[model samples]
Target: MASEELINARHAATAGLIACASAFVYLLARGYQARRTFYRLRQQGMPMPPWNFVLGHLLAVPPIMKTLPEDTQQPDAFEALCRANEKRDADSIIYLDMWPFADPMMVICSPVLAVQACQEHDLPKPPILHAFFNPLAGGANLFTMNGPEWKRSRALFNSGFSASHILEQTSHIVDEAEVYAKILRQHARKGEIFSLDDVTCWYMMDVIGAVTLDSRLHSQQQFNPLASALRRQIRWHVLDNEWNLLIRWNPARPFVQWYNSYQMNSYIAQELDKRYAEWTEDEAATSSRSIIHLALAGYMAQQKDKPRPRMLDAAFRDWATVQIRLFLFAGHDSTSSTICYCFYLLQSHPEAMAKLRAENDVVFGTDITETAKMMREQPHLLNRLPYTTAVIKESLRLFPPASAMRGGQPGIYLQDDKGNRYPTEGTNMWILHSAVQRNPKYWPSAMEFIPERWLAEPGDPLYPVKGGWRPFEHGPRNCLGQTLAMHDVKITLVLTAREFDIKHAYDEWDRLHPTSKVKSVNGERAYQMQSGGAHPADGYPCRISLRKH
Candidate 1:
């Protein structure tokens, strides 16, 4: 009986050894396959970064993440990488094997190539972004969908952004600008160092709420819950690298998605429910004049035509959430960033500020309300404000709100005007606007904040210089809210310039905290402004006094 037991034990040990050996062989095979794929891509003349056997370019990922101070550095790093690659005349393809994926990830820099990859429909949505945004948002929003779905959703949203609609929104934007002016006047009287970033973000939030939801919100007011929540959500989505890691790992993604849905989507739904209920109870009896009302009316009309669409109630609610969220996100951060940078540049170049104020004085005389009215009455005045437009344009070029990326799939090709074909298959390509905007090749004296570059004559060789522009990006995938953004910027500048002569309180640019998404001049997350809204922590501290002009 002892001998029979020993034989059984020996057999079990042998089986265990065999299973361990098989597992080792499988891992080794995968490693070899990944290496082989990397080399195959290189041989096909594809641009790629160096990779480790198992982790592709992940070792570099952490460094890239670390280089930026969560608020400004990520965007800056992306721009820096793009500039470095452009200098090398190398295609913008960074190899990333952070995942157990088939090929190295590619980042695209060239505008023509980015347009081809994004608009030609040759590339698939980046898997991480797709899974994170689409599933969480219910696959109905423009940012999440691809191919036919994206096309349809885009069609619906595009109708509301037609030229006429943009023009019509200008009056509303100017109204908000008056509010900003009043706030700045009050702050200036108190002589406080205020955070323009926070104030501007709130300003934008209120604007989006009014325009999209038809709800008036005092976003700039201290202790506003909705505004605070919106700010928190923005900070997380734009600045959090841990979230990025979770999304990269497939197994952990569902949990991350659930967390995001719980935090963002559900919260938004609750807010909407409360607002909708209030509207039904109090405002339904009166004529509604907000964009939300218009959208709801349009939606109802469409639903009446087709009674049995898929998840009609859920879709409408989700659609409203998307519209509001998109506007809130886009409006708040983009506008705030623009305002911060504009102030920075203006302060750095006092001559530019002087010129801007001079122009403001000529356009509006002495009254803030008159200035607002003139801005609306002569929209062309904005287009014609050579130096003001130049400064705004230059700032946007340096610190774009959105970074553009392209995904790789089979049969995808991007050919430049020079006939340089860059493979877009099975790779990711990103156009860092900061990099493109600041390239010395594209803009001579790239590091200098010179608004004059944009004031050159249309046909002049220096006009926009090659590869130097595109703050709003070029082609179909560019910012959909460009018009609205421009309007907001114009209104804010006009109002702020009218009330105060803004100057940098901090000596250097380093005073601001730079993050991946928003650029803050000061290390603090919020700035105390002497006038107007609180500046973002990543923005420079600028002092403003009543304008002597």
Candidate 2:
């Protein structure tokens, strides 16, 4: 009996080893097949650069990354890589074969191809988006969801961002901008250099809370748990230009993620519950027209013939909280980065600055002090400041924060104007916003800070191409808070553009920075970095002083 049992055990062990060997062989076969397929396609006239059969683009990416500074963002590197490989006149969409480290990516380098991917095909967001955001959002939110579920969620959340609703909520944005302006004033008085990015982030958060949830976080004035946690969580989300062992191997990161999620989730839930109760109680006389309130109303309206719950249901609360957090994260991050860049660009070019101030003076009245008050009373007047709006447009053209990251599908192939088609199967699709937006073929004087491009008539060379200016992106999956974001940036510009001049203190920042002597990338001190979002390096360390009118 013992001999029979030993023989059976040996057979089982042999079977297990064979299974493992077979799996390894299968993976090797897949790798070899991927290499042959992509290389052969490229040789047959695909615009993609050659790659190593064994290492894929794993070895390729780091060498290109080495061109820019250590802190230069992946988006920035994407442009550099594309520029190195792309034919100036050819219809180009560069494909990088990143394996094991990241998913294989087919980057859309031209606005025409971008339109094909985003509009024509309307591809779903990549699974990596969900993988990256799952921890941050608690689960898949608007930015990550795809297909039928995505469509349903998108429909439910649409009413909250209607122009009418956003108009109702512009005052909240102005209110928060006033607090931000006051904080800037205090910074100005101190005559000290500080992080415009950090402070701007706080202000955006406050605005998000007020406009979205009808709550006063007062993050600018004091320490807020939600704000702190959000920062930590967001920082944790940034992929290092290197191997990123700081995050990958840190055992404490899981606890940190849990704690931060708990804090943000708890705060969002508590605030949402208050609004939920308010909606339940009144229904008709709903005093607040915040984004979060409208979203909740939208979700509730979708309940066909279901009995209304006295309290918030689990599914309702969970889904609602995730959307609210999405608003909080997306609203604050990209908008804040734009605000910093607006300051950085305006200070860099005084001609544009003069025109901006002149426009503001004409629109907001000569007394810059009253711009905030004027904006709050008549928020629609911001729409009237075409040049001011144009400056924000131009700033976004130069420094778009993020884009809709779509996954490559089996049958989808992006076709350019030249009739060139590229296969996108089994890969992640990314439209390099900087490359597409600033491509000289699309935008004349693309590298220059030209606000007039947005203002020029259709026949003119400087006029924006139809699909070129995609800072907030285009198509159905475009940014929901884009209108709000435009208004928020305009309001901040109105409040601060004339009152204070914030200039980059990069040289001083580098001198003062204890650990980082690393300053500037390709002579751009204010280059954007991929830290949670495309943000100015070192929070755009700068000195602020009162502008002499």
Candidate 3:
């Protein structure tokens, strides 16, 4: 009886403690401490959009139902709302309290301010912004790290992704492209309507897997669960529900993520372990200059001293695995979106397609067999396809794969060039792509598909704006795989244009998904938001046929 009474008493006490903790967290999240931070920033004269108590400016976010028109007064619904809030107020910085208990974000649209944010080494990416992607980095990889660690990781990847290095990997890339070309050719023969988005994704997964990890995922041949999971993971990173405690805390959620992570990490670990063992057995036996080889050699060299570096440890293993996953997550979907959009844009504009085809024919030659042979032997000839490259630039300009974000230092507010002080303390800075790429101030006919703008000579009016275009971003933290990504894109274009002419399979797509409305650009249906990257709404339903010489 005495013991029973003691157990009851303990249970009651524990329940009380949990309740109190819950209340404390609720108060902190429901504008208790966060409200204090808000008022402090407001007191500093920060420009703020009207926000409600809990949801903040979430209500201001335009619904997906509201279509983005090509010739609309507003470029996008978000930008439209920002302009509406800025009526008579000329502040370039807009503040939005996205979460009830979180610090309001400072949305920096001014390019001048953006340049400062990009250039400042002290400014870091906010942890909250990257919480979704932390799993990919295991809390220690390049994308999540800041300061000295970031610099070290960035330097380590530089040599591997350089122009000369990516140039050497062209044969592998071409081989992958050939397999992809054969797949598409098979589809063309059947008069099948296929998803360019899907095929490009498979090809890129194969290329990045081969080049980065020296593993052939064979994504083109069959369904790779790891590739699918990585794609899904990238999409999940941008979801609003990703932060919801109820969903995140659900048992099934972590189980799925853990399973995928385990599978991917295990495969990468096996490869890493095998490579390390082989090199240890005989370093001269493994002389291939793959990215993983170079990285492992560098780590081994660093650890030759007294204290061994963490490169060969569990954390390093996870980090290496995460990077391969990151390449798939970051590289595959993004490049796929870009290539998919390129085909979509070309199909919509026959004139542009003709021009691109003409350029490819002249540079790559009209004979498919000869062209394939030449591409395999002299892959660098891809550099001569300037017009095709311009079309890609235009596609990227219209649809940037990602947006730029940076962290706001504790007390420092960003000041615009015109002496306007914008409060940024305790805030994450978002440089929205719509504001930069589609802003009329930067490019003429911002909503139109104009590849010639990129092709403009120095003294021409259509020349790209000096600081306006940043598809790959511009700074110390620019994409490490920019050259490789562009090369892959260009190679895909060269190979495809040589053999097939792609057209939009609108009829089949519409019949299957009647409820879907494709997003419009310049009064034409073109773009759609899918997962993380923008793709044609109908999964970019494409019909390919052999091009007549």
Candidate 4:
């Protein structure tokens, strides 16, 4: 009986070994296939960095990262990689192979190529993006949806983001911006440096929260659960650009991710249910007429001749949970970065800063303290500040939070102006907005901060070329929240630009830390880094001083 038991144990151990070996072989085969396909595309004229079959282009990431600080976040590596390779306008498209982790991804540096993929082709978002965003939404939303589902979602949400609607919501936006300005005032009073990014993140939370559902989440003033969860979700998120495999695959990550999702989704779902309850009751229930309520109305319109249900459909409610989550996350991350960079740029360029203030003061009055109140009273007046608008545009062009990332599909290819076709199958597609926007080939003096580029006449050399400046991107699938984002940024700038003189505190931060690496990206101290979405490095530590008028 003992001998029989020993034989059975030996057989089971052998089976486990065999299974492990087979799985290893399968991964090896997949890796080889990726290399073979990537090399074939390279041979066909797609520019790629020197390769390491096992590590793929990840081999190149470290060398570029070494040039900057160690703790710097992702995407800075890819942008640095482009510069290191001396990638030129002619070299419009570059492909990188990242196998056994992520699929191969391509970066389009030329506007012509960007349009081909984003505008003309309108390619679907690759699966990897869905995987990246899964922890946050865990289901289809506007940003990730493609084809029919995307079309339907886009139509439904379009009304909420219409130009007229955004204008109407301007006063609500100012309410939040006023809170943000008050926070800045507190910082000014302390006479100590503070992280503008930190406060901006909170302020944007309240703005979008208020605008979306009339949510009174005063994240700026106090600890807000929804806001905290949103930040955690981004911090916990492992983007493809996060090159650390171990961190990406950490076991602890799932629990935190699941919790954050639950916390945020439940919070948003309650809001939805409350609104739906109001929606169904024709007893003239008080409604916020929020972006979400408008969206819910749109959903009801799609019911056609079906009987008006007493309760929101469970399935639609479930889907709307993820979409609202998308709005909160996307709105907060993208605009926060823009606002920080605008301040950083204006701080650096005193001339442009003066021009911005002049525009604001002339439009809203030199009594800077009263501008926020006046803006709320006559929100339409905010539209009259062209130079202020120019500053925001230039900031976005210089440091776009992110571009539209599309998934490659079978039978689809991107074409350059020369009519050369580049197959996009089996790879993730990116327009690499930073590259296209900052390239001197596309915009003269591109590396410099110039707001006038947006206002240049037809004959000026600094004039923005058609299809070149794509901060919010261009085409059918362009950002749905663009009008609102612009209004949000503009409102914040209007309220704060004249009242406070904000400047980067990187020098002091470096002094205190004493061991930080190279402080600038091509001589600009406030470089874009990955936080939520392309946030400024180290949350843009800066000191705000009340400008003495």
lDDT of each: 0.60, 0.81, 0.71, 0.81
**Residues 358-393, candidate 4, lDDT per residue (tens digit)?**
888788888876887788788889789899889999
**Comparison by lDDT, 1 against 2, better one:** 2
| Model 1 agreement with the true structure over 139-161: per-residue lDDT tens digits | 44566456886675556566456
lDDT string for model 2 (146-229, tens) is 788888877766776788777777777877888898899899999898889999999998988787777788999999988888
Count steric clashes of candidate 1.
44
Candidate 3 lands at a TM-score of 0.89
> Residue 454 error for model 4, in Å?
0.7
Q: Residue 543 of candidate 2: its Cα lDDT?
A: 88
Worst 10 residues of 4 by lDDT: 83-92
**True-structure lDDT of candidate 1:** 0.60
Any runs in candidate 1 off by more than 4 Å, and if so which? Answer: 1-35, 59-72, 78-103, 119-124, 131-140, 222-225, 238-291, 305-312, 373-386, 416-420, 465-468, 507-539
lDDT of 2 at 153: 79
Candidate 2: what lDDT?
A: 0.81
Off by over 4 Å in 4: 1-15, 52-55, 84-89, 283-289, 302-310
Models sorted by TM-score, best on top: 4, 2, 3, 1
Q: How well does candidate 1 score on lDDT at residue 132?
A: 33
Model 2 misplaced stretches (Cα beyond 4 Å)? 1-30, 238-242, 285-287, 302-304, 514-518
Worst 10 residues of 2 by lDDT: 513-522
